[model samples]
Target chain A: MTDKPATPRRRGAARTEELLQVTLDLAVEVGYAGLSIEAVARRAGVGKHTIYRRWSSMAELLLDALSRAWTSDLDYRDTGDVRADLREQFLRSAPALSSPPIGPVYRAVIAEAQSDAALRATLHERFLVTVEQRTLERITLAQSTGELVDGVDLEFAAEVLCGTLYYRALLTDRPIDEAAVDGLLEMFMAAYGAAG
Target chain B: MTDKPATPRRRGAARTEELLQVTLDLAVEVGYAGLSIEAVARRAGVGKHTIYRRWSSMAELLLDALSRAWTSDLDYRDTGDVRADLREQFLRSAPALSSPPIGPVYRAVIAEAQSDAALRATLHERFLVTVEQRTLERITLAQSTGELVDGVDLEFAAEVLCGTLYYRALLTDRPIDEAAVDGLLEMFMAAYGAAG
Candidate 1:
């Protein structure tokens, strides 16, 4: 490990990852309300001035940290069947949402979004738009392949599936197990019908 | 209007309604964070003892007041068609939810529920259970009557539809208008299909 010296670019990326990890850890322990620039700096063992230089405010820092944490790419594999692709996505992602760190962070962000207009706006622009747009695009692929009907509303279907998942996670505090993934997919297929 | 004397039961109910109305108005004016039992009593022109007698705490008072404002009960009219019936129910409730007063109150309650176990328990018992059960029952009726498939997941579908409308109302501050209701229903019908 001591054989080679690291480049500045590699060092910068490493430092960024460290800051994000600290942010996530602190967010879990004390929640969004307890989060602040000073605390994040102290937690990361970095100066408050450095944190401010990287991000304008705590909200900005937290948003960046969260956006980076999410596996930023959608896995819209054309399983040759549209419904099957959606089922795969849900199965993969639902568990992450149900897990400890992600679940708590998601809930805290949602609670904060209720009252924080600026945070809500950033949430819509960064997190929500990507999910909604990607889901629609995947649904559109199904429609073009004649897997779905000509006039089906993809946005509405996407929202029903994704929005329902978020609602259940926040509202019920129940774990989204394999059974729920199966049931949700089945219901979606039942409503949308199977691809030929 | 002043010609007839009010009956005892009618008079009691009227006074209760007046108290709830005043509470709602104060909530709108001050907000959840600023609301106080004394303020509510003063605004309602009722004794503080009377307010405390009716509700054990501020959370209970808020719940009762908001409950009075909700008109979520469905008519369950046999339209002889499940799709039409579902669409009508979804559309009929959308505008009221999209209204400024109702939407904010919903957000306030949900935010309060996160930290207050008492509020959480009451919300689940009073609101969530009723929503889930009634929607499931309605969908079950459709399934039995051959309007939907027997394998359709009633619980998931009910949650999906309600959750979608609710997420839109609470998060976006956008109107869940007739168009959105139509979009949601179209997707639901497409997924459920015409078979029983």
Candidate 2:
């Protein structure tokens, strides 16, 4: 009649997710350097052991939080319009990278990674490289369907587009707003998009 | 004829140049946050007053060092070869932003500027915006002379090219080396190069 007991795996996963959210939140409040394991545990109402058991160091915890924060699992439309699809894809990730909570946490992590090699490796592998791969795949798909031009340099186009947005997100006061996105989309489209 | 007595203005200018070189060296040795006016004065064999007189704070000192470090008053060739000129322009700045002393100093300032607002604004104004303006001017010149195609987004092209390099310099282990520069030059040329 009643609900079944939760599995150990489910309990462990739920706790981990809760801890990640806590870390991400703390990243905003205290930033990267001040975000200690002890502080995260206190904020999450979990024992220190709960977090340490999952992450051996604050660096590892920061990387996990960053992976989640920068993740962009976009549901891009095939409106047969490369420009619109590109805009949609960019907007999907821009909010995660520019809005509060996640954005500040990401900025703190990026700033920290400048001096931390192991952390930079994790960021390069998990976020920068991963995002580039996903974007390249989308560009390749666009090419196959004739949305993008044939024989275009896939890596160059993808990196430049994403790099532009990351430029603004990390360094500039200008957010990649709708207008900026449109400009980016148009620039990229002129470079790679198929003609009408 | 006896040499004219060294005017105070000439003596002060020489001392300022020596101080800037000292600070740039300290940036390589101790990094941005660790650099101090005292150390710069000690290394340059000048009084701390020499540096403090020029820059009121370490942040201002850092910006001055960065501006001098990155500036390249290149006499670019209009050799009717886009790739060659592109390579030359990129290589000119790459050494400054990638080599010892200046390169490390620039990296240190960039890392320091990430969390520092006043420093960031100084960097954004003195180096980033200035460099972009010069680059945009060159692109405009190319367009006018029929090197690059007409109606290409000049700002977008310039920013993407430089932004790609900045991304590597600030965030990753990969240096903006020859091959990387080649890829970038090709990308820009493909999108905007005027046909023969």
List clashing residue pairs in candidate 2: none
lDDT of 1 by residue, A97-186 (tens): 546676567666767777776776666666666677778898888788777767767787777777776666566555566776677777
DockQ for all models? 0.45, 0.46
**What is the Cα-based lDDT of residue B168 in candidate 2?**
68
| Docking level for model 1 | acceptable
Give the Cα-based TM-score of candidate 1 against the true structure: 0.76
The models' CA-based lDDT, in order, is 0.72, 0.75
Displacement of the residue B193 alpha carbon in candidate 1, Å: 4.4
Q: List model 2 lDDT by residue over B105-149, tens digit each.
A: 665666666666667677776667777777787778889888888
What is each candidate's fraction of native interface contacts (fnat)?
Answer: 0.46, 0.28
In angstroms, how far off is B101's CA in candidate 1? 2.4
Q: Which stretches of candidate 2 lie over 4 Å from their true place?
A: A1-3, A37-57, A70-78, A88-99, A173-180, B37-56, B70-78, B95-99, B173-179
lDDT of 2 by residue, A1-196 (tens): 3688788999999989888888887888788878899999999998899898988888778778777766644445677666777788888778876567676667677777766667777677656776777778778888999988898688867777777778766666566789777776766776677878
